[model samples]
Target: MELHELESAWKTLDAQVAQQDVELKQLRTQNLRMRMRGKLMRASFGQWAQLGIGLLFALWGGSYWFDHLGTPHLVAYGLAVHAYGIALLATAVVMLLHLAAVDYAQPVADVQQRLLTLRRTRIRSERVCWIVGAVVWVPIMMIALRTIGLDAWLANPAWVLGNLAAAVAIAAAAAWVMWRRPAWFAKLSMDGPLAEVERQLADISELRA
Candidate 1:
């Protein structure tokens, strides 16, 4: 072959190879995005389920509180439960909003940042709910007893007080533990879908780099 013709052929091959590389990267990115979409869908479903449950709790608590409006202790118990339900609803809403805010079309770094924010919010909310649940159960139990036609507080004020004290102690201890050893709880938070998404994002970023 002529030298000039040979050089032209070589340049054509190089261009083809570069095009294939671009196409391959695009394919890999698309596949990663599909996987990420599936993960986000699953996470969204979970949040929707939580939202439904929160709504149910709020409805029940609201009705209970309304019914016991004339009784101070029962009203207090009902209000506490109602507030817990509201908190749950709020958490669900916030999480769903964060999920919605995640734009897959953006760069991987941006998506990862949003996912991390969601994960952080989720972990903090879960911690709050776990600690508060310890004390919230007292009110729940009181409401349950009331449902069965028993005024627990009136029948055994000392018992009720004791239970309240124990719950407070438990909640306080849990809070202290979480505050002192945050890394322990952080490990626990690293298992969810958001964490998985973050991991995959890191891998994708590394591959692209």
Candidate 2:
């Protein structure tokens, strides 16, 4: 073969290689975007479902309270139930709003910043959940004890002290469990995807640079 013909063949092969590289990069970017969208959708749906359930409970509690409006004592009891439901709904709404605020089309740094903000929010929300649980549990336990005639039993000093200790123990256990539960679940659903997206965004930033 002529030397020029050999050179031409080599150039053709190089061009093909370059073209394939471009195509492959494009495919990878597309795949990453699809995965990111899937993560976002799943996270959004899960949050919405949580919020929806909370809203339902809140409404149920509200209805019960309204029905007992004339009964001041029962109305007070109803507030304990509403306290938990309202806290759950509020926290979920805050999370959803924060997630919605993230602009997916933004620059990598901006997206990362938003995600970090979200992580902080989740941490704060988890703490708030425990606090709310602790505050609400006392009334819940009181209501339960009342139903079992333990409220009257508490007229005795010893019985009152024992009941109060039991209530405190139950509340502490519940708060600890509630605190750990959401963090564990978020590791699988929320934190995992957020971290993956951050890594992907970093890669994209490097490529752009």
Candidate 3:
């Protein structure tokens, strides 16, 4: 081949390589955006479903309680039950609202920060649920005692102690699942989505560096 022809061919090859690099980068950016959007959508849908179910359950229970106002069956812990229901509904709404604010349009770092904030919020909400459960459990025990009669409850110290032990065990199990378990559903659904986003963010940081 002539020298001029060789030089022209090399220039063409370099230009093609540059073009492909640009196209590849563009494709990667598009893919990342799509993935983040999908993650946000899934998280939002899950939160919305939770909120809808919780709201329906709370309303249904509240209506039943109202309908049976002053009934003997609910007389002992009716107020407590209503309180617990309201607390549950409030937590669900808060979670839904927080998830709603999770915007994927932002930069990768911003999105990761938002997701981390959400994780913290979820942890706090779980703790709140535990506290509310304990609060409601007391009223439940009160109802149980009333139903069995105070005399019978006093006569069965072993049963009372057993029930207390069971409650403590259940609470401990829940705490373990929330804080220690590696494959919790909330982590899978919520944190799992952000894993890709975090990877992209790290990639971006490296590129910037």
The worst-scoring run of ten residues by lDDT in candidate 2 lies at: 152-161
Against the reference, the lDDT scores of all candidates come to 0.85, 0.70, 0.64
By lDDT, the candidates rank as 1, 2, 3
Q: What is candidate 3's lDDT per residue for 1-209, written digit by digit as tens? A: 99999999999999999999878776777676677668756766766765665566466556656765766445335555666667667777777676677665676667667767877666676666775575457546655575566633446757755765776777777777667774564555345555565566566555434
lDDT for each residue of candidate 2 in 1-209, tens digit (9 for 90 to 100): 99999999999999999999888776776677667667766667877887887787677667766877986655665676776788788888888888888876776678778878887777677666665665565555655776677653335546544755776676677667656786664563346666677677666666556
Ranking by TM-score: 1, 2, 3
Question: Which pairs of residues collide in model 2?
Answer: none
How many residue pairs in model 3 have overlapping backbones? Answer: 0
Q: Candidate 1's residue-wise lDDT over 7-42, tens digit each?
A: 999999999999999899888888888888888888
- Model 1 misplacement above 4 A: 2-7
Q: How high is the lDDT of residue 112 in model 3?
A: 67
Span of 10 residues, lowest total lDDT, candidate 1: 187-196
Local error of candidate 1 at residue 22 (angstroms): 2.4
Could you tell me the TM-score of candidate 3?
Answer: 0.62
Candidate 2 Cα errors over 4 Å, as ranges: 1-9, 66-73, 141-209
